[model samples]
Target: MRHRRSIDLMPREDAADDGATLELLPEWYVLVAKCGKCRHQGRIDRRLVANRRGWGVSLNSIGPALKCVRCGNREGNKLLLGRLPRD
Candidate 1:
């Protein structure tokens, strides 16, 4: 006899659009942080951020907490969702 396993395709309640935590983000998605002051954009690694700030941290709370490495802009930072390449 062969055993079949079921996978959960639904996202959790804590995993909303933006208010979700780093680990809640799907594998096909990536996190990007942009600076409003300097207009600089950078890609964020979910595992890295989660390791540094823990997995339970909210995405919204991360934006303002980060400083733009380019212009050193500490305000008006926003977190955006980016998609990974299918290939």
Candidate 2:
């Protein structure tokens, strides 16, 4: 079974009386994983890439990647990687 997930690559605004355009920066990429069989949705942080080297990899080599916690799907598991906007 395959599941579809919706990932928000935009910043979310909080409720405020001020009309100013507030830009919230996320520390990491937010990933939304959904189950196709049950339609269950879940979210995971993409910061895991930082620890890839496991020993001492330079921060420059670490790129942005997201994984699905629910479906065990990797960033390259499907074409969803390109769908995300570049920072």
Candidate 3:
């Protein structure tokens, strides 16, 4: 005999605009991740992508995963932005 597992399905209400006041903010900058091997740097404007998520955010999601424009090597490409400095 096979047992079936029950799953829960629910629709969440959208609270896009809940009488909240909106404020105008200044522009921001994009932290770019530079490739260690070839010295390739990726630039992301601050007004764009928010803070890093989880262990760290991947380069592919933010923008075009850049290749070493100088060396053409894809391996060992380092994240040059949105990460804290190593101690």
Candidate 4:
């Protein structure tokens, strides 16, 4: 069975709108990725995401594509997009 992940942070169509609006998202995101098998979690910097345009791909598509550095597993890895705490 193929496992599909949903980019629930934003609708897939919404994310592909434009780079200018998408650029602002990285600033607001606390990118958290978790492995479904090992339950390992990692944080990704905004800068890393800012550089990748991934044209024709929505930001939602990027999260599920992340591989777990610890286990090198691609399947079952979940990406979480959370907002930074307001001061």
**Model 2: how far residue 26 lies from native, Å:** 7.7
Question: By descending TM-score, how would the candidates be arranged?
Answer: 1, 4, 3, 2
Per-model tally of clashing residue pairs: 0, 3, 10, 0
The candidate that wins on lDDT is: 1
The lDDT ranking, best first, is 1, 4, 3, 2
Better of 1 and 4 by TM-score: 1
Q: Rate the local accuracy (lDDT) of all candidates.
A: 0.70, 0.33, 0.37, 0.59
> TM-score: which is higher, 2 or 3?
3
Residue 32 C-alpha lDDT in model 4: 77
Candidate 2, 1-87: lDDT as tens digits: 222324443212121222321122133434344443344445433344334533243222222233445665544322111135557
Which wins on lDDT, candidate 3 or candidate 4? 4
List, residue by residue over 1-87, the lDDT tens digit for candidate 4. Answer: 222333334323343444433354546556677777787878866556557744344556665677888998898776666566557
lDDT of 3: 0.37
Task: Summing lDDT over every window of 10 consecutive residues in candidate 3, give the lowest-scoring window.
Answer: 5-14
lDDT string, candidate 1, 3-82, tens digits: 22122222122233545677776788777788879988888788888888999898768877878989999998777666
Per-residue error for 36 in candidate 2, Å, reads: 1.4
